[model samples]
Target: MSAAAPPVSSRLFSLFCLASYLLSLSYGSTFLLSLLIGSRGGNELDAGSVISAAMLSTFAAVIVSGHLSDLLGAARSIALFSLLLVVASLGFALTPGFGNLLLFFGLMLGLGWGVFYTLGPIIVASLVTPAQRAKYFALLSGSMMTGIGSGPLLGRAASALGYPVTAAFYLAALASLIGALLFWRLDVQLKKTPSASASVARISWHATARVLSSRAVFPIIMVGLGGCVFGGLSSFQTSYAASRSLDYSLFFFGFMGAAISSRMLIAGFVVKRDPLRASCLLSGLMMVSILMFGFVVDDGFSYVLAAMMLGVGYGLTYSVINGLAANEAPSGTTSQSLLLFSLSYFVGVFGFPLLAGRIIVEHGMVTLLLTVLTIALLNWLITVGRLIWRHVSRIKTLQQA
Candidate 1:
C-alpha cells in the first residue's frame, strides 16, 4: 500500500506558497548582499560580478537538474535541493569574508535555486491539465511577484528597526527551511522517468543535444532576450536609486506590485491567445519602460510610474514565456525543453549584467539603460518578424491547398 497523494489544488497551492517565500528570500538576500558587499570595501562592479556568477551557476545547475529530476522524480529532487537551499542560506547568514560569500551565497545558493526552479515547473506541468497551464502559471508568476515586491520592504524594515544584519539573514534562512519542509511533505508523482542504467543517466549529452535541435529553441531564445531586460533592472535598480538619492524600496515595491497585478490580471489572456504576439508587445513595453527610467531621475512619482511599467511588462512576459516553453516540450523530452528555457533566462541574467557592469562603472546607468533598450527593441523585432513569417507561410499553404 502507498500513501495517497494530495489533491492537485492543494499541491499547487503549496508550490505557489513555496515559490513566493523562496523568491522573497532571494530578493532580500540579494539586496542585503549589495549593501553588505559595498560596506565591506566592494563596489558596484563587484556586486554585479558576484550576482552574475550566481546566475551563471544557476544556468549550469538547471541544465543538469533537468535530467536529474527526470531520473529521480521532481518531488524527490525538489526535497533534496530544498535542503541545500536551507544549508546555503544559513551559511550565507553566518559566514564572513568575500570568499565564503561567493562560495556559499553565490554558488551553493544558486545551485539550490536552479534545481528548485526547474523542478517546480516540471511538477506543475505534470499535475495540471494542459488547459490549466497558462492560468496556473500566471498564478505562480503572481506569487513570485508578490515575493519580489515584499522582499525589499522586509529588508528596509529590518534596517529601520536597527536589527543586526545577522538577524535579518537569519530570518531569510528560516524561510528557506520552511520552504524545504513544505516541499518534503508533497506526495504527488504525476510521471516517472524511464528506467535507465546508472551510466546512461550520468551522461545526459544526448538529452541536451536533442533539446537543442527541437522547436523549443525559439521560445528559449525569446525568453533569454526578455531576461536581459529584467536582469539589468534587478542587478542595478537599487544601486541606481541609491546614486540618485531615491528610495529604492518604494520604487521596487511599485515595480513588483504592478508586476503581480499584471500577471494575475492579464498574463493568461495574452498568453492563451498567442504567445509570440504577447512576447512582442511585452518586450516593446519593457523597452519603453527602460527608456523612461533615463528621464525620470528627478521626480519620485515619475520614477515610481516607470517602475510600475517595468513591473507590468516583466511580470507578464516571464510567465507567458514559461508557459509557452512548457507547452512546446516534445514527447519524452519535456524536461530537456524546459532546461533550454531555464538556461536561456539565466544566460541573459548573467551575461547582460556582467556586460552592463562595465558600462555602469564607466559611463553611468543612463548609458546602460539606453544600451539595454536597444537590445530589447531587437528582441521585439525578432519575435514579431517570426510571427509575421509564420502567418505568411500558413496563408500560402492554404492558398496552395
Candidate 2:
C-alpha cells in the first residue's frame, strides 16, 4: 500500500477556514443581488433570471474548475476564481443599468463561487484522514456558514448607516481580493511541503459516469432538492418578506444562526449515529418549516421560528447527506463523487430560482412555498427509501449466508 497521507497542520487548516469565510462572505452578501436589481429598476423575474443565468455559469464552471483543480492545483484554481469574484462584485457596484451586462456579471460571479466551493472540500478531504473528515468538514462548514450569515447582516447594517445597499458589492469585492491573496500564499506554502498531496489525478469520463449512476445518486438528489428549497427561499426573500410586510433580516439571522450552530455542535454526532434516519427526520422538519413559513408566519416571531426550523433541518441534513456521499463513493471515485455532488446541488440552488421567480411573479408566494414543500417531502421520502433498501440488502446477505 502507498504511504499514508500527511496530516494537515493546524495553521494550514486555520488559513483554509479563514479563506473559506471570506469567499462565502462575498457570496452571502450577493444574496442582496435581488435588492440590487430592484434598485436598478428590475423586478423579481429579472432578478431571478440574472441569478439563474449565474447559476448556469456556475454549473459550467464547476465542471471546468474541478478538472482545472486536478490539473493546475486547488489553491491556484481558488485564487483565480477569487479574482473573478472580485471582478464580478466590482462590476455589480460600478456598472450601470439592468440589462444583458448584468447577466455577464452574473456569469462571472457564478464561475468564482463555483470553483471556490467545489475545490474547498476536495482540498480539505485530501489533507485530513478518513477519521478526521467529518469533524474537519463540519468546522469548515461552520466558517462558511458564519460568513454567509454575516453578509446579509453587514448589508442591513450598511443600509441602516445610510450607505447604499450596492456598497455590499464593493465590500464583497474587497473580501474576494483578500481571499485571493491568502489562497495564493497557501499555494506557495504547499509547494514547499514535499509530501503535501495538493491535487488528485483526473479520472476517466466513463469512471465518473459510473460513480454518478451508483449510490452517489442518493446524495446528489437530496442535495439538489435541498438546494431548490434554499434557492427559492433566499433568492426571493426580499419580495417574499415585502408581501407580508416583514423584515427579511430575521430569516437570515434565524437560518444562519441555527445552521452554523448545528453544524458546529451536533452535525458529527447526528451523522455518526445514523445518517439516513437523521436525514429523514431533518427533511421532515424542513417540510414543516416551509409550511409554517407559508401558512403560519405573519409576524416576526413566527417568521424567525420558521427560519430557525428550516435552518436546523436543511443545515444538518446537508451535512449528513454530504457524509453519505463521501462514504458511499465507490473505491477510487471519491473526488468524482464530491464533484458530482456539488454539481447536482448547484443545479437545485441556481436552477430553481429561475422557475421560482416566475412562480412568485405569476402564481404567488404561496404557490412557490407549496412547490418547495413538495421538494422537501420528496427529499425525506428518498432518505427513508434508502434506509429501507439498506436494511433489505443486509437481510438478503444474511439469508444467502
Candidate 3:
C-alpha cells in the first residue's frame, strides 16, 4: 500500500485559514448592498435582481473555476478570483447608479465568491486525512464566519461615522487584495512542498454524472435547502426588520455569534458521529427558528433569539452536510461532487432571493417568511427520511448476514 500522506504544515494551514477569513470578510460586507440600493432610490426588487444576477454569475464561475483549479491548481485559481473580488468591491464603491453598473459589479463579486467557497473545502480535504476532515473544515468555517459576522458591523460603523454605506466596499477591496497576496504566497509554498493529492487532472463529465447520482445526492439536496433558508432570510432581512420595527443589525449579530460558537465548539464532535442524524436534528432546529422569526418574534430579544437559533441550526447543519458530501463522494470524483454541491447552494442562496424580492414587493414580508418556513420544513423532512432509510438498510444487512 502507498504510504500515508504527510501531515499538513501548520504554517500553510494557518495561511489558508487567514485567507479564507479575509475573503469572507469582503463578501460579508457586501450584505449591505441593499442599503446602497435603497439609498439610490431603488427598491427591494432592484436589489434582488442585482443579487440574483450575481448568483447567476456565481453559478457559472463555480463550473469554470472548478475546471481551472484542476488545470492551474487551487492557489492560483483562488488568487485570480481574489483579484476579481477586489475589482468588484472597488467598482461598487466608485459606481454611482443602481442600474447596469450595480448588476455588473454584483456578478463580478459572485464570481469571486463562487470560486473561493468551492475551492476552500477541496483544499482542506486534500491537506488532511479523512478523520481530520471535519475538524479542519470546522476551523476553516469558523474563520469564515468570524469575517462574515464582522462585515455588517463594519458597515454599520461606517454609516455611524457619516460615511456612505458603500464605504465598506472600499474596506472589502483592501481585504480582498490582502487575501490575494496570501493566496499567492500559498501557491509558492505549495510548489516547494507539493502534495501528492494535489495532482492536476481534468474533470470528466462521466465522473460528474456519477457524483450527482451517487450517495452524494443526499448532502447536496440538504445543503441546497439550507441555502434557500439562508438566502431568503438574509436577502430580505432589511425589509423584515422594518416590518418588525427592529434593528437589522441584531439579526447579523445573533447569527454570527451563534454560528461561530457552534462551529468552533460542537461541529467536529457532532458531525463526525453519524452526520445524517446530526443533520436531522439541526434541520428540526432550523425549522423551529424560522417559525419563531415568522410568528413568534415580537421584541428585540425574541428576534435575536430567533436569529441565534437559526445560526446554530443552519450553521452546524451546513458543516455536517458538507462533510457528508466529501466523505460520500465516489472515488476520483471528490472535486466534481464539491463543485455540484457549491452550485446547488448558490442556486438556493442567490436564486431564491430573486423571487423573494418580488414576493416582498407584491405580497409582503409575512408571505415571504411563510414561504421560507415551508422550505425549512421540507428540509427537515428530507433529513428524517434519509436517516430512516439508513437505519432500515443496516437492519436488512444484519438480517441477511
Candidate 4:
C-alpha cells in the first residue's frame, strides 16, 4: 500500500509555515548585515538607511498587492512575489559592495517581502473556518517567530564556514528558493476549490485610501504599532549592546528564546471573541518591555531580563494585533484591511528605525530610547483610551435607541 498524501489544508498550512520561515530567515540574515555594514567603514546611520529603504520598498508593494491579491488570487500572487525573493537572495549572495546590497536586498527583496508577508495570512485565513482563525493565526505567528529566532543562528553558522559574509546571502537564497517552491505547490492546491473570498470585487484606489484613513480603522492601526517597536529593537539591539559593552550574541539569544516561548503560550488566548481586549493587554506588556530596554546598561542579568520582556511583549503584541485586524476587516474589504494593517506595521518596522537612526546619530542612544519610550507610552494611552470611550458610547447609543 502506498503512503497517504496529506490533505489540501495540511499542505497549504505547511506551505504557509515554510513561507513565513523564509521571511524570518531573510530578515534575520539582514540583521547580521546591518552590523557588518557599520564595521565595514560605513556609518551606522547609513547602514540603517539601507534597511529603511528596503522597508520603504516593502511599504509600497504591500499597499498595491493587497488589492492585487483579491484580483489575481492570493496563492498566485504569493508565488509571483516569491520569485523576487529568490532573485534578490541570489543577487545578495553574488554581488560585491554596499551599493549592490542596497539595490538587491533593500529594494528588490523588500518588494517580495512586502507581498509575501501581507498575503500569507490572507491565504491562511481563506483556508480555515471562522472558529479556526485564531488558532491558525497563532500557528502562523509561531512559525514566523521560530524562523526569525533561528535566522541569526543560521547566519552565524554560515559565517563559520570561512567564506565571505556574502555566503550568508547564498544560504538565504537557498531558503528563498525552497519557499518559492512551497508557495507554488500551495497555489496549485488552492486552484482545486476556489475560495469564496477569492472573488471579492476589487475596490478602487480612492476607496482603498478612504478605508486606510477612516477613524473606525484607527484602533487597528494603533494595535499594529507593535511593528515599529519590533523593528526598532531588532535593528538597533546589537548597537545598543555594543554601546553598553554587553554581548550581542547573548542578548539576541535571550530575545529570540523568550519571543518563541511567549508566542506559543499566548497563541491560545487569541480567540475570535474579544481580539481587541487581547490587543490592549498585549500593548500594555509591550510598553513595559520598552521601558525595561532603557535600563539594560550595566548588568548582564538586566540585559537578559530585558530581552525576555521584549520578546514576550513583542511576540504577543504582533499576534494579538493581526488577529484583531482580521476580525475587524469590513465585509467586502477583508483583504484591504489586512493590507492596511500590514502597511502600518511596515511603516513602523522600516520608518521608525529610520527615524531612530537619525536621532541616535545626533543625540546618542539615550535620547533614542527616551524618544521611543515616550512614543510607546503615548500610543498605549491613546489606544486604550479611545477603545474604552468608543465602547461606552456604543452602549449609550444602543440604550437610547
Q: Judged by lDDT relative to the true structure, which candidate is superior, 3 or 4?
A: 3
Q: Best TM-score goes to which candidate?
A: 3
Residue 216's lDDT in candidate 4: 31
Badly placed stretches (over 4 Å) of model 1 are: 1-7, 10-16, 70-72, 97-104, 164-167, 188-203
Collision pairs in model 3? none
lDDT of 2: 0.82
Q: Give the TM-score of candidate 4.
A: 0.86
Clashing pairs in model 4, backbone N/Cα/C closer than 3 A: none
Tell me the RMSD of model 1 versus the true structure.
4.4
lDDT of 2 by residue, 343-371 (tens): 88888987898899889889998999999
Report lDDT (CA) for all predictions: 0.68, 0.82, 0.82, 0.68
Model 2, C-alpha of 294: deviation from truth (Å): 0.8
Tens digit of lDDT per residue, candidate 3, span 1-401?
02366777888888888998889877787667777788888878888887788788887787677577768778889888888889888887788878898889889989998888888788777777766777787788778877877777777788789988888888988998999889978887876664435643334678778988899988898788888898888876877887889888899999999988887677767866878788889889999999998889999999999999998998888888887888799887776777788888988888888888899889988898899999998999988888789889999999999
Which window of ten consecutive residues has the lowest lDDT sum in model 4? Answer: 1-10
Clashes of each: 0, 0, 0, 0
Q: Residue 224 deviation, candidate 3, in Å?
A: 1.4
Cα lDDT of candidate 4 equals: 0.68
